[model samples]
Target: MKFFTCSVIMSVFLQVCSQNPLRYWTLLPNILVVEVNGSLGQQPLSCLGSPQEGTRKDDKSQGIIWRKNGVVEEQRGNSYLVQLEESLGGGNYTCHREDGSLVNHTVVLIQEDQTERRKILVKTDQEDYLTCLAQNYNGEFHCSWTWNRNRVGKVALIQVGRISNDSDAQCSVDVSTQRWTCSSGQSNFSCSVDEHGHRISCRDEQHCPYAEEIQQIYVTLYVRTEQFLVENYSKQFYLAEIVKPDMVRISEVNTSMIEWSYPSSWSSPYSYFPLTFQISQFRRGCKGCDNPCTESKPAKTLMVHFTDVCQFKVKHKAKAVCVRAKDALCNSQWSEWSHLRLRRNNKNKHRQNDKQG
Candidate 1:
């Protein structure tokens, strides 16, 4: 019975593939996918509707017509040019010969500019684990994101560019490994999705630290699952702006004081990539507490010099303590707070009181 079900499923899959029109067209070698973009008057859409290559022996005798949104716009031309504002320029553009046979069809999507799609990069608490990080101005960076719980998806496409419209870029995937590779005029890189297809990691080849302010990395990821669901997520950022340091670890050095050190993964020689420490005291029971960092009236904020182990006396009689850190220079984002439990030693307290007496 199982074998029969498997065979029936395979037959249905092949039948669906045969019914798809683009399936066979995409297999043809040397097929051209023409793309164009334009603004109001600065850029106009002048596109050729015929194949650039291959001989058209009857072209001289046949007349061509171009139409935008099913309305005839041009009567004769090998290439059609639109000299209108971009807002009035987008439509289903088609080309035909005098014989009333369709020669080509192209979809013109008009936009103010390419960066319009970059507004989706805002961070939110619901975001699972989507993050893009780079330590230096070097051309190498990594982007990783996770999906909502119980939702599974695989990366079907990856696009990267400085502008939004330059998305003609392509990425090749390794099915066995789920890794992706893409290259552009100014960037070259590869990425890999995890086994569950919820996480991605990328490396940039042409990244450079020069002109950091003017440079930005724009990324778009298309994900699809077995249920035929598709989604696109996009983000844009500069390397330095998103460089988040890992959480600092705090440990008790003595009864009177606690010490903390930088995360092991942070940039080397601590002198350069220093981090500031923010210590917040929390009692066993607190009402309407703000975030651990801001819970106290005035957080005990201290600047820890690079390359130094930070030590601060725990003067508060609070039951618990929380410590977090952030980059000293940019102060971009804070790391996760580390919690410590205080074990009050009454013997030591008595000894200090006796000495005072």
Candidate 2:
């Protein structure tokens, strides 16, 4: 009995450590991943400015070079300081030696922070409800929201209850481990917040679907800022209706052949968790066309089974292609499309053949 208890405790400890945010933060490379709000500001990213890994003292004397999206970047320092103009601060930045050898590479994926201004205008009210989404049909869902303008806060507590007047249950959070656990009736809930306090993700430990009219899960969130202002938000949802698969990533693009894989975050076992796919093709239009949206046409629709990769043979004239997937058997919602531009390689192949001869 004592041995069994020890083994169980060790398993729990390992699970908690695996989900620890501090560990994740440390693992992140010197890449400064930021969301740009069209503001000129300095991001104190020492990681980008720091001398390249394995860079010797002699190499530093030779000076370092920086490039943005393959174009040479101005300004010399351990860090790359620039105005966050949409055209300027976004894209892949690489530091190289004066000899043109690669040193370090940092990719800055800048998403538009559209909520910056609206957040300042809108005030947090008691009537405000959190928005939730289930990326896949089974297991979990994520909830995120912007706090009242000018208020920085942390999630103080989380509560769960059934929509059917069941007793309210509480979730305990381990700040160091960054895990939340709760037990409400027969369902067990686990949740985690991101490095930023805006998003929260929860999983149902006992989620099993049975034929029924409808079912709902209720979640409550309590947030507290440094000023001690406590505000709570609640939301109720049915997983089936809200299940939206994430955009499938296009992995391989070849002549008339496009291949993709399921999102890694999806629930396991492709045979059991089947997903239907949708493909769209965008052909080249008249030069200087005003709108390309009117030129898109449905390409193909298929299902992913037995294998993780989905391949489609499209027409040779196709210029661009897109693919998306959703729950195959269930009446769940479809996923946003994953897009790719096809660069025909017939000329390059013929050139290679001539060179070989």
Q: What is the RMSD of candidate 1? A: 16.0
What's the distance in Å from true for residue 248, model 2?
2.1
User: lDDT tens digits, residues 217-239, model 1?
Assistant: 77787654433233457788866
Which regions of candidate 1 fall more than 4 Å away from where they truly are? Answer: 1-152, 161-170, 175-177, 206-214, 227-229, 283-307, 316-318, 344-357
Q: Give the clashing residue pairs of candidate 2, or none.
A: 49-78, 49-79
TM-score of every model?
0.54, 0.52
Q: How does candidate 1 score on lDDT?
A: 0.57
The ten-residue window of minimal lDDT in model 1 covers 20-29
